[model samples]
Structures are given as C-alpha cells and as structure tokens.
Target chain A: MLVIGELINGMYQNVGKAIKTKDKSIIQKLAKDQTKAGASMLDVNTGPASAQPKDAIKWLVETIQEVVDTPLALDSTKADVIEEGLKLVKGKAMINSTSADDDKLNTLIPMAKKYNAQLIGLAMDKKGIPRDRNQRSELALKIVSACMEQGFPLEDLYIDPVVLPVNVAQAQGVEVLESIREFKLLSDPSPKTVVGLSNVSQGTKNRSLINRTFLIMAVGYGLTGAIVDPLDKELMDGLITAELLLNKNIYCDSYLDAYKKK
Target chain B: MAVDLLKEKWQNKVGTITIGATKAEGGTRASTVTVGGQSTLPFMFGEGDMPNKPVIAMEIFDIIPEEWPATLKEPFKDVMNDPAKWAKKCVDEHKAELICIKLQGTHFDFGNRSDADAAAAVNAVLEAVSVPLIILGTGDEEKDNKVLAKVSEVSKGQKCLIGDATDKNYKTLAASCLADGHSIIAESPIDINIAKQVNILISDMGLPQERIAINPTIGALGYGMEYAYSIMERARLAALNGDKMLSMPFVCFVGQEAWRAKEAKGPQSEHEDWGPESTRGPLWEFMTATCMLQAGGDILIMRHPKAVEETRKYIANLMK
Candidate 1:
C-alpha cells in the first residue's frame, strides 16, 4: 500500500492554525510522525484557512522537506497553488488531483509533465461523482487517455474512482470497487488505483471499521495506493494483513512491523 | 538487423537459505550448503537466473530399517546398526552433500525410543559428518513434538535443517527451531494453499522466512508424479511472480517415496518383461529425482547411493 498520510491537510484545527500562524514546528512534527507511521508520501493541502493559498502550499511543502525526505503530494483545487508547491519539491512529487474535466486535464497533465509529478485523476466531471461504475470507468479512461496523448507515463498516473460516504451512497461502494478493477485495463502498463479512503467512512460512527473494511475490499480489487490516516493502527494492520493474504508480501512473524518498514 | 534477446523479467526470486554453520561462523561443520535463490525456472539460463544448483541428501534412520530390499540395503549394510557410522558412510563413501537423519526409532509403532535417544543419534551424526544435516521427525505427532524439540536443543546453532512441521501441528517444532537457531522444513499435503498457509503459520510463531523450506508432500514416479509436478510448477511460478510466502525452496523426499513403489521393488517373476531389480530400483529413484528437479525441487532426499550419484552427475551437468 502506498500510504499517503491524510492528516497534514489544513482542514484539521491544529494544521489550520499552523498554516495561518506559519508555525513550522507543528507541520514538521506531523511530517516526521506520519513518515514514521508508514506514510510513503504526505498529502499537503492548504484547505480553506489559507488566505494566501499559493504561499501556504509552498510553505507546507518546504516545511515538510526540512524535516523528512518523504515525497510530497501537492494538493489543491487551484492550479497555481499546486504549481507553487510542485516547484519546491526536490524529488518526484504527486499532484493530489485533477478531475476528468477537460480544463483540469489540460492544465494538470502539462503541469505534471513539467514537474515529472504523479497525477491522481478522479473519475468525475462538473456533473459530479458518477452514479454507476460504467460512467466512472469512462471518465477514468479519459484521464488515462489524456496522459497517453500528452506523453505522460501511465505508470505515474493514479485513477481515483471517487469513493463516497457509504452511510448514504451504499451501492456506490461496490461501483467504486468494480471501477478499480476496470481501471487496470485502461492502458497496458496501467494507471495505479487510489482512493481517498476516509470518505467511505465520513459521518459514520464506526469510522475506523468502515474505512478498513472498504480498504481491504479495494485492495482485493487491486487498488494500489490510498490516501489514509497512517496513524490509525487498526486500519494499517488490516491493510498489511490484506496484502499478505494476497501474497503481495513475504510472510514473517512480525509482518505488521515488516509492512511498516516497507 | 540485430535480434533482441528473448528473456523473462520476474519481479521476485526464491529466498536463498544457508544450512549448517561453518567453524568460523560458530558451528562445527567444515562447510555449509546454500540453496534456493533462483529468479528463473530451473536451468532456464536465457530467461533468468538459477543461482544455486539443486543438491541431494541421502536418507538415514536412527535405527536400521527392516523394510529395505536387498538391492537398496547393499551399500550401507556394514554400517546399518550405528547411526553415526551410517551417516559417515553416506558422506565418506558416496560423497553425499547432505545427510537426512530420520528419527523413525522414536515412533510409537517403531521401538518407541526415548527423546534422549533421538538427541543422542543427532549428536552422533553431527560428530560424524562435516557436511550439513537435515533432521526429520517421524509422523507420530505426539512423539515428534517431544523428540524433535530435544534434538533441536541438543544440536543448537548447528544450522541443521529440521522439519516435517505441518499445518495441523507446527507450533512446538517451530518454537524449538526459533529457539535453537535451526532452519525448518514445512510439509504441506501437495496443496499450494495449504503450503502457503503452513508457511504463514510457522512464520507467525517468530521464525524468519529465509530459515524455512516447503516440503510439498511428493508422489513417486508412476504414482501421481505429474500431479506433484504441476503443483510445484505453480508454486515456482507464483514465487517468480512475486508471491513471497510460497517462495521457499522445495524439499522433496524422493527416495522414501520412490522406494515404496512396486516398479522399484517388485520381483522380476511378478512382471516378466521388467528389468532386473538391482538396476530398476535405483533407476526409479533417479527418474523421480529428475522429475522433481525439473519441477524446481531444491533439496531432494534419496535412499539409494547409485541414484544419488546419478542425480549429482545430472545436477552438475544441468548447472553447466
């Protein structure tokens, strides 16, 4: 599992205050802690709190780099804010996302190519998240096709089926899983599949349980990466065990420890 | 125009395991044997790498066998009663690379010897052979738990490959191997899922993956050999395709299974067209070993000296 820590985003109270106050300590500590908790890449979002969002994204990216070497995921709705963070990353960065819309694809794919960043493509347009998996697959294919046309490597592209809160859109969970499986055939080398995992459990009482169960189901359908709370031990353990049973990892007594190291 | 070379690129390879610690590495053995680090199928040089050659270990028992045919027993008749002498004969005379000591004497159906006797036999063999040892416990589950644990403790750090731990009963033996720093042989009843599950179970008990091998219970020649081959082929393929739990080198007990076949032991009078029993028995064992090697067997345990010699020659030639 390519765990992208979802905790460092500016939506959280501590992160919002830190992003406003330009508090480097809080953001740096979260970066180090998330990396130690098994975040291969940290998702950096400036959220609605940042008045100067472009500068805040750069600050988050630079502040994270000073403490940990983990790659950054430049996250924002605005192209310039993402580009600001993308410019500062020393290593291969991830563009945390673009939608299937032509405008988003036109801007982000070129930007991803310029920065050599991995692009996460959500299967939705201005019409909103698709009601069925077929529409999702079609939108996901558009994203893959755009990357191919632009000469961006499909291996560096990730397709998100746009997971919804299961408490309301229960049937869409199945559609998302089917979309994950279908997304593999969009190209030869295949765009890796990822999901913002916490969305499935949003507004639910058993948040951890729902997130882990859905995560394993996604993994079974060949979802390669996930935006998740790496600090959630139960969720991480479930993911590690799921991969082990799928024969993706070599079994050792301390597989939980092993997966953390991996 | 230049032709592109045909090659296969696998994501993973079998785990390489070293058996028996040398004197410098904290054991008394003169040498150690390493097996199972192949990125490709057996002997497929063009596709990938088979880093280590398949090796053979001749089988001996704690007590002299009562079921051996005259043709099979002729080589080691002189040293039959003494376990240490029997192992020495295997290594000294036949140039055996590894010795597998079966604690058959401790079985309830056998003499029901004490665990102390089993430990003593292992000690004698460790003293007798400079090469690595593979100690196997008898299938008597209750007795094996008691006997193999003592044997594992007595031969601590010798790095002997001790096993026959299965899915049903493995905790005691796995813990013993972990405590004593010995490698283990996990046996599955010719099922790939069970094979993987057995590995996971043992691994869950604290033993590392490299210190384990899979004993996919084999079928002798003319008796479900193809079935055994298919299972091993799938396992090897899974391993190459990056399934880590199934990637341990295979350990096939060829001699014990082959000798049980009527083709290897039946008298000529029973089948008029069949060749002399003397050569037929060893040939059966050799053919079975050959089949296993092609199916990616890493350590083949055989009984006949002539068959072991032939397999060694074949392995040497195959490596070249």
Candidate 2:
C-alpha cells in the first residue's frame, strides 16, 4: 500500500508553529519519523495557519528533503500553492489533490502534466460529498475520464472516494468501500485508490480502531493507498497485517518490522 | 488488439555488499568480490537492474574428512590436511572468487580443537589465498559461539563473510563480526519467517542489514531443493517489493548438499544404469548450483572442481 503520512500537514499544532517560525528541526524530524514508520510518501499541507500557503509549501518541501529522500505529496486546495512545492521537490511528486469538478481539473491536470506530477482525484466535486456508492462511483468515473482525455497516465492518477466521518454518515462508510472496488475497474490497469483515512474516524471515540478497521475493509476492496498517520503504531500494524492477509506481502513472523524497514 | 505487457516498478533494490578488503581498505586480499544490488529476480534484466553477477565460493575444511568419495575428493586430495594449501588450490585452480573455510575440527566430537587452533587455520588461509574468505563454524551451536568469536577476532578487518548465526545462538558472533568488520551468514531451516526473524535479531544487535547474508539452509537437487528454491524466490520477490528485513543476499551450500545425495554419489559399479560417478556427480552439483543462482543465490559455496568450473561457465553465460 502507498502510505502517505498525514502528520506533517500544517493543521497539526507542532507543524503550525514550526511553519510560522521556519523551524527546520521539527519538520525534518517529522519527515524522518514518518518515513521510518513506513510512509512511502509524506503529505505536505500548509494548513489554514499559514498566512501564505504558497511560501510555506516551498519551505516545507525544502526542509523535509534536507533530511530524507522519501517523496512528498504537495497538498493544497489551491493549484498555485501545490505548484510552488512541485518546483522544489527533487522527483515526481503527487499533487494532493483536486475534486471531480471541471474548473479544478481544467487547471490542475495540465499543470500536473507540465510539472510531471502524479495527481489524486477526489470523487466528490464542487456540488459536495456524494451520499451513496453509485454517486461516488459516478464522480470517480468523471475524474478518470478527465485524466484520460487530458492524456494523463491512468496509473499516475490516484482516485480517492472521499470518506465522510462515520458518526453522522454511517452509510457513507459502506459507500466509500464499494467505490474503492468499483474504481479498480475504471480502466485496464485501473486508477490507484486512496482515502483520507483519518476522516473515517473524525470525532470518533476510538479513532485508531475505526481508522484501521476502515483501512482493512478498503484494502479488501482493492484500495492501493491511504493518507494516514504513520506514527500510529496500531494503525500501521493493522495496515501491514491487511497487506499480508491480502497476499500483497509475503507472510513472515516479523512482517510488521519488515514493512517499517521497507 | 495489440497489447502491452505489464512490468513492476520495483520500489526497492537489494543492498550491495563487498567481501574482503584490500590493503588500502585495511585488509590484504588481492581483490574483493561484490554481490547483491539486484532490483529484479535473477536474469530478469529488462524489468530492473542487476549490478553484480552472482559469484562462487569454493569450500575448504579446517580438517581432513574421514569418509570421502573418490570422485569428489580428487581436486583437494593433496591438500586435505592443510587449510592454507587447500584454499590456495581452490583460488588458483578453480577460479574461486571466494574461499569458504569450514571449522569442522572445532566440533567437540570431531576433534574438540580449541579456538586458538581455529584462529590459526583461518589466519593461515588468509595468508595463503588473496581471495575473500568465508569462515563457517561447525553446527555445534554452543562451541561455535566461542570458536567463531575467537577466529573473528584474529581475522579482524579482513571483511570475510563468516557465519551460520541461527535464531537461538547469534549474539557472540554478531558482536564479533560487527567489531571486526565482517558480514554474517544467517542460517534458517527452510522457513522464510525464521529467516527474516534471524536477520531482524542480528540487525537489532547493531549489525547493519548490509553486513548480513541469508542462508535458507538448502537441500540437494533431489533432496528437497524445491522447498529451498521457493523460499528464496519468495524472499527475492519480497526484497524487491520493499521488504528490507528479507532483502539480504543469499549464501547457499550447493556442493555440500549435492555430494550427500545418492544420485550424485552412486557409482556405476554399484548401479549399472546410474551412469559414471565422474560425470553424474559434477553435473549434479553444477545443476544444483545453477538452480540456486537462478533463485537469487549470491555466494555459492560449492565443492567438486569440475562442477564449480561448470557453474562458473554457467554464470558467465547467464551474465551475457
């Protein structure tokens, strides 16, 4: 699974202060810790705290790269802010992300191609989060078609069936899992599927339990990636076990340790 | 419809390792033999990179064997009593890239030789042959811990690959190898999980993953070689698929296992249709080594000069 660490975003209090003060140590340590904890990529979002998300993006990318070579996911609702981080990242990065609205895709797809970046296409659009699996799959189809028409490689596109917090939207949990399975049938190779994993457990009492249970179900539905807290040992262990049971990783007694080291 | 084949974007590559150090690197080997750094399964060059070719390590003993097959014993018969001369002959005559010296004499039943005796034999081989050495201890777990530790101390800085470090007994040798700058051969009894766990345990003891090689204890061609091969194949796939704990290179005992089989040892005098022992024995060893190399074995510790020569030719052919 492509685990993108969600802990480095500016929304986190430590990261917000670090961004404001230009604290390289905090960001660098977070980058190292996340990668060590089995994140294949780190999501770098200059959250609402940053007065200037654009400049903060560049700082985060440069600061993280100084310590580790794990790839960064340049995240922002603003295409221009993501573009700024794209300029500094050493290799192909993931633009996290754009919803299935034409206005966003019209700008981001070409920009993603211009910078040679992978893209995460959220299934919901400007209309808002879909309430059912069929609507989610329809929006996901729109995103896939847009990428296909724009000549962006399908495999380079990650399709996120945006999950709402399960407390109020219990049915949407099943909706998201079904959408992940449907997304794998989008094309011959299929679009990679991811989830904003923490959203499943938002405002929940047992956040880790909910997040990992949802992740394992999503994995069963052929989910390929997740934006998650790699530092959560139980969550990461659950992901490793899910991958093992799915036969994606060969079974071994120390697979949990092996996954982290990988 | 015209179709395109799918290929994997391998997320990780096996770590490269070099055995033996030159004069400048703090040891006195003529040249070092490097292995690992493969990003694909053996011979799948187009899918990924294979930085180094698989190399062979000729096996020698610290003591002469009591029971010997006439065909298998021909090459080293003269130097059976001498470790130094035996290693020299392996390097000079068989084009051995590495010399694996087994401390068979240190076993309590074999000879009960002291650690000092083992260290002397290791040093003598180091002095005789400039090729990298692979020092292995007898299977007696407790005694090997003491003997290998002392030999590792005496041969410090040579960067030889010494081991047989198992799940239960590894601390003494792992520390000595770390202190002496040598790689270890972690052995597991045909179980991939135990194989990975051994590496994790050794790495936890402060030896870097690169300083370890896996020995997924192999069987001869007819005697359960498939189990070993599948385990190695799974490990290689896991390694390339980003399993760092299982990513180390493999060291297989091809000649030892092959020679023990009746198919490789049975002479025509014993069985008329079994073929001449001369050709059948070496071919058995060669085929065994070939399968192991295909399964991603890095250092092949083999016996039988003809078989070793054939395997060397096979390796060159596979490289091209």
Q: Which of the numbered candidates is closest to the native, going by highest DockQ? A: 2
Best by TM-score: 2
Model 1 segments more than 4 A misplaced: A1-5, A14-95, A98-118, A124-142, A149-151, A164-185, A200-225, A228-262, B1-8
Interface DockQ per candidate: 0.18, 0.67
lDDT by residue for model 1 over B88-199, one digit each (tens)? 9999989989999999999887899999999999999999889999999888789999999999999998999998899899999999999999999999888887887888
> What lDDT does candidate 2 reach at residue B46?
80
Q: What DockQ would you assign to candidate 2? A: 0.67
lDDT of 1 by residue, A15-106 (tens): 99999998999999999998998888999999887899998998888889999999999889999999999889999999989999999999
Worst 10 residues of 1 chain B by lDDT: B238-247
Docking class of 1: incorrect
Candidate 1 residue pairs in clash (backbone atoms < 3 Å)? none
> Candidate 2 at B103: error in angstroms?
0.8
**TM-score per candidate, chains pooled:** 0.80, 0.96
